[model samples]
Target: MLGYPIPANETQRLAALHQIKLLDTPDDPVFDRVTRLATRLLNVPIATVTLIDADRQWIKSRVGTDTRETTRKVAFCSHTIAEGAPLVVEDARQDPRFSANPFVDCENGIRFYAGIPIFSSEGYALGSLCVVDTQPRHLHEDELAALKDLTDILNDEIRLREHLTREQQRRAISQRELDALHRSLEEQIERRTRELNLVIESAYDAYISADENHRVLDWNRAAAAMFGWSRQEALGQSLQALIFPHGVPEYDDATPIEVNACRRDGRETPAEVRMKSLRVEGKHRYSLFLHDITERRQLEQLRDREAREDALTQLPNRRALDERLLDAMARARRLQQPLAVLFLDLDGFKAVNDDHGHAVGDELLRDIAKRLRHSVRETDYVARWAGDEFVIVLEGMAPEAIQGLSEKLILTIEAPIQLGEMSLYVSTSIGVASYTPASNETAQELLKRADVAMYEAKQAGKAQVKIAQQGKA
Candidate 1:
């Protein structure tokens, strides 16, 4: 009651604990299995996975306990979390921290306890996996090691659950946005349809009316201008022949769709078309609206390209590199060809940033990216993996060719870069790792080998190449 331990980073630690979303949740078998294994392996009466909250220790999984939680001040796991390490109390009755505690002094009191702190991805102590014994007992070295390993497994599982929760929340937000957009679009269409004739003459979109037989009944000035025909010439013309010379696009309902619209000058324009069916004088008629969407489509394409490209260098980003790696590996496996990955790191990049400022450092990186791109064949995939780091995936290349390319890239990166008036010099350390069908290595494994080799190159000297030894799964 008098000696409550609190962590230095209590606030961040509590936030991380709640972010995992395991506190006060239903019992998960995955965690329960680990607790059960701990009880069996450690010969303990109770094994629990406990999360330390602001005022309570919530048990997420338990092997021998009906109680869900206990006050943090009285919980032994609290001390374990406070230490951020494994806490082993061989005899709680003799230990000063638990000698007067109710859980230790009460009938059938806890006498032995061992707990390993579980950490969050950001290195905050979230909780602990603990075992309790009614009789005082000492844990053997092997038992302590086993407990640590099981705690690591729990740490991974907790991180995975947190990641999945974040992904689900992200997807839910996107779905809600899509639904709102759909609703808004429908409302706009309905309102525009009600005020059609009032604004048709001045509206930017082309409006056309035709009978059920597809013969034009009315043509607005916008339609004539869009199709390069006068209203007098457009009226009474076959609607399909006037704009849809390539044939009308498929539009099942009032939803808008993109189609190729033919102009009188024989040019094709991308347009968004919306059709509405109406009955006038007991005769069926179709009203069409066409809006040119060329600029919209081009903007969308640019957005997609930016998503996969690095903004600074206009090179493929890490996301694009990952996709390319997977595709290249699949093709190599199918064709029984050799593939290689060249990992590059700019030497003394941090020094450049510190001495010349990030602006100049950025210019240097862009120059390096360009040089690396030019050094490799156009068929090779070059991507900016991260700041001052690049990855190049090459397929159907022999080991010797890959070696030559890596050396060339090193030399190419060593050249002076002119940033306005100042000429900056930097070199690259290159690592080459190859993969074949017989190697049975994953894309990540291959990249990791190359990265390790690059570090070796850096350790050996500033500007050099290191080839990675072939690795297996």
Candidate 2:
């Protein structure tokens, strides 16, 4: 049985041990020299720079030993690390802890043992510099001091080996990542090449690709037909001069360059160009994909407008609110200004939906959304939270101003909505909460408080505004 005890903060010690990175490594001459000296000076058959880890004692350098590791429970170095100083046992057979130990009882009987703790610069005991002999021998004070000096040397060597191993592993990992990136780039190039071939074969637009030096590498059938020159003549020509004959003189240097290509019958056609960097055959290159987007640009603009605008009420949706809210919250918090959040819910929306069709109710709700937006300041945001719930975020407002705004919101929604020939009436309940620097609450928590206040308002009356109050203990 081993008498060694682990440190209370063993995790921190082990982390520091790993930081040195000296465990289970190939032999170093720096460590080998000291262990060799330890064997000679201590007059021992075995000398080792032994590191006690979580489960085993690893030999960093072994002068007269063939084994690399031994169980921690039976390791003498474990006791050395625990003692944090030299542990000299003149006779293992007389020492109770080692009397039954295999090293003492077996053929390689250890009667003489002297171990000095190897400590980190920060003073954590890592392992030991130890010497063992079969015959019993006592160590003088001078010999013990010499052993301590030898341990310091071994500690320095272990630290150096750890640093070197970590650096080597880092370089290996970096090289592996670079190799993977290169393979990924090659696969991407092959995939893009196949896609370009398909586009050239089927597309009506004139497509072209070029090297990094701006020399053409690909001239599609459409490009050859559109330009006056055949595919053979246009294969390696300068795209700038050959295509944009009358455009800006420095068009080639301009970013996202646009140009006009001349046809064989002396007709000019418009084209849009985009350039991308690539690698080919171990060399850097660039590619240009051209399109006739004159008519397509109008349709794309229409699509972008539809994407940004809400389809039902034609108002900006929660996505736009999120973008604006981030900026607003940042500016308000920076200035130590207060911002108000209002959670609004329609009082009789479900009744309307059940009585009339959903379509009519939706139209009525859209009318109500327009009214609320018109009532608020242009700087304030009014966004639909869900089916019949909306939220308004007012920036740079005081508590009194927030109270006034919440009341105005309720009054605005309480007014009758004129949908076609019929008049529909609905009420809104609002809960208001403010964000203050003194509160230290998160944005989500503040919003939740506002939501709870809104429910409180709904409970109090059909159409009212309520401010949140902290419940008394």
Maximum-TM-score candidate: 1
* Cα TM-score of candidate 2: 0.44
What's the lDDT for all of these models?
0.89, 0.79
**Which parts of model 2 have CA positions greater than 4 angstroms off?**
1-4, 9-28, 63-69, 106-108, 120-124, 173-217, 221-473
TM-score for each model: 0.55, 0.44
Task: Write candidate 2's Cα lDDT for 324-375 as tens digits.
Answer: 6667678776888878788899999898889888998999878988998899
Q: Give RMSD to native, each candidate.
A: 38.0, 27.2
Q: Model 2: how far is 306 from its true place, Å?
A: 36
Candidate no. 1 TM-score: 0.55
State model 2's lDDT: 0.79
- Report the error of model 1 at residue 219, Å: 1.6
Clashes of each: 0, 0
* Pairs with steric clashes in candidate 1: none
> Which residue segments of model 1 deviate by more than 4 Å?
1-196, 420-423, 437-442, 471-473
